[model samples]
Target: MSQSSQFKAMEDYFQSLLNEGAPEPSRAEPAPQVPVPAVVAKPTLEKPRQAELEQLLAKVPVTKPTVAAPVQAAKPAVPRTPAAPPPVVWQNIQTEREFQALFFSVAGITFGVPLTELGGIHQLGKLNTLFGKPAWFAGVMTQREQQLNVVDTGRWIMPEQDATPDYQYLIMLGDSAWGLACHELMGTEWLSRDQIKWRDKAGKRPWLAGMVKDKMCALLHVRELLTLLKQGVNIDGV
Candidate 1:
């Protein structure tokens, strides 16, 4: 069939249906919209209440930053002063019977004589000149009811001192009448035998036995002096 014809038929068919009073097609109803539940927002906190809460929180005590105290170094202890040293004590010891000696000077030369060798020490009381004697002999002095023949020790050692005759002491020679005129009598002193320098042989003067280093004096040998006296070297200037 031709397209115009087919359209005419359909139009006639619809017209017939209208004439026949055909029921109109029912339209489907749209489904009812579901009601959405509204979201209820919580109320915002008030500014004043927030401020009060902040003030209460501020009132609470907070721990402050603690700074450790500086450590102090201990001071050094002061050292005590040492005590003074003990005083020195000198000891005098001797094994043998020999002991201290006495010293005197003549012509500025010191001479030491053993204390055991001395008979006595006397004062130069009224020195009476004896004739027919050498210039070395000073004079005579009476001591202890005995005549002591005093020799000028200074002049004997040094002939230059003969004119002045400066005699002060009469040192007796071992219970003999012979005595030495000394200007001074020095005190006694303890000396060890090792301190003296011994002589091997007799020198020009037998009386000088050794040298005493302690007092820088010549040590007199009493034995040699007695031997020389026995030889009558200076007896009456013979």
Candidate 2:
């Protein structure tokens, strides 16, 4: 009806339309519905399988530090056997009671006598030849104020034996001297008492004691040998 009333009515109607266009107090749309999935439990392992895994771990070998052994030295070899010694040879000289017979070779014949009976062996020195004596009597020589008579035993023993001018030595038997012209002096050998095998004395001459071992060896009584020389019977020849 009037202008004011019309304006008021129009305002009222716009207000009512705005209020109707506005959503009514929105109930919060329930949050979009989300479903939570249930958790699935894992299966437990067997005791045997766990034990086998532990055994495999134990079986795995571990490395260790090593030590070296000491070395030994070689020994030298020894000799198995020893050498032997040589043998000994001895002389047959036994007793002092038995005399040693020294031999000399004269004109290829050997003659020996006991060294105990020998006075001495001397080198031929200055001698005096006596006249009117037997050819077997070599000469008379002077030595130490003693008159020495020499006899050539070889010539005396065998009348056919020749005289050797190179007589160099004079062998003195007791107080008498005899020329023993020998080629060489043989070595001495011991003659035991048992070695002298004596023969019958009754059949023997005064110059010989007895036969010794088949030969007529004079039992040289030095005095008697000299006596036979003085008599010129050629003691060696007799």
Candidate 3:
């Protein structure tokens, strides 16, 4: 034995190094325990495309914004009054040279006067006032037997008679013997200097002298009021 075969080859290399460090022999059925997945925390969706664009803008149809009704101003129309101008008749009579006058009225205006300057009409007796005489005389009145003097043809042409004028008739002026008085005796009227409208001077009553066109009267000039009642002249001072 050569040392017992060299110790039997060193005990077969130490039993092959203890079979390569000894931990590789498991039977393969003990490897099934892998369950570790519990982390769930994903619930926060406020802008899911802005909540689907506000649910497609709440299905489309909302248009309310109209307030227009306040405009009222139209009311002003009423004005009418004018109607009166028609009374002046004497249509076209072509002149010749006629005469005869008289036509009277006084406070409501309308006067004529030439019956060749008259000299007789009488019947208006009692009127005695007479102090200094000239307020258009208006005093003495004995008529036909003469004393006449009277005058007052509306106080010798408007000396104020706001209604208190009765006057029945006296007239008679011719030779400055005066008398006159009168109110409403509208009697005679024949006219024609083409029915007068003379006035070249005497403007504001020097006894007028023109305008008789078919009875509108105002012709009076009785010879300039008989030379201003023979110059005792009051020229209408009142």
lDDT of each: 0.72, 0.62, 0.71
Question: Could you tally the backbone clashes for each prediction?
Answer: 0, 0, 0
Q: Is candidate 2 or candidate 3 better by TM-score?
A: 2
Residue lDDT tens for model 1, 1-238: 9999999999999998787866666687977999998998999879999899999999999999999999999999999999999964322222244468888866566788878778788877898997877677777787667777877776666655444456677777776788777878788888778888777655465577678876778877766665555454542223
- Count residue pairs with overlapping backbones in model 1: 0
Per-residue lDDT of 115-231 in model 2, one digit per residue for the tens? 765777766666577888877777777778877777766786676767656666676675455544445666677766566554333232344433235333433445445567767
> Model 3, 144-200: lDDT tens per residue?
676768777666665554323678877776765676777767788677787697776
At residue 234, candidate 1 shows an lDDT of 44
Distance from true location, Cα of 228 in model 2, Å: 0.8
Q: Identify the leading candidate in terms of TM-score.
A: 1
Clashing residue pairs found in predicted model 3: none
Candidate 3, run of 10 with poorest lDDT:
87-96
Regions of candidate 1 where Cα sits further than 4 Å from its true position: 1-98, 229-238
Q: What does the lDDT come to for candidate 2?
A: 0.62
1 versus 3: better lDDT goes to: 1
lDDT of 3: 0.71
Could you report the Cα RMSD, in angstroms, for every candidate shown? Answer: 26.1, 27.7, 21.6
Candidates sorted by lDDT, best first: 1, 3, 2
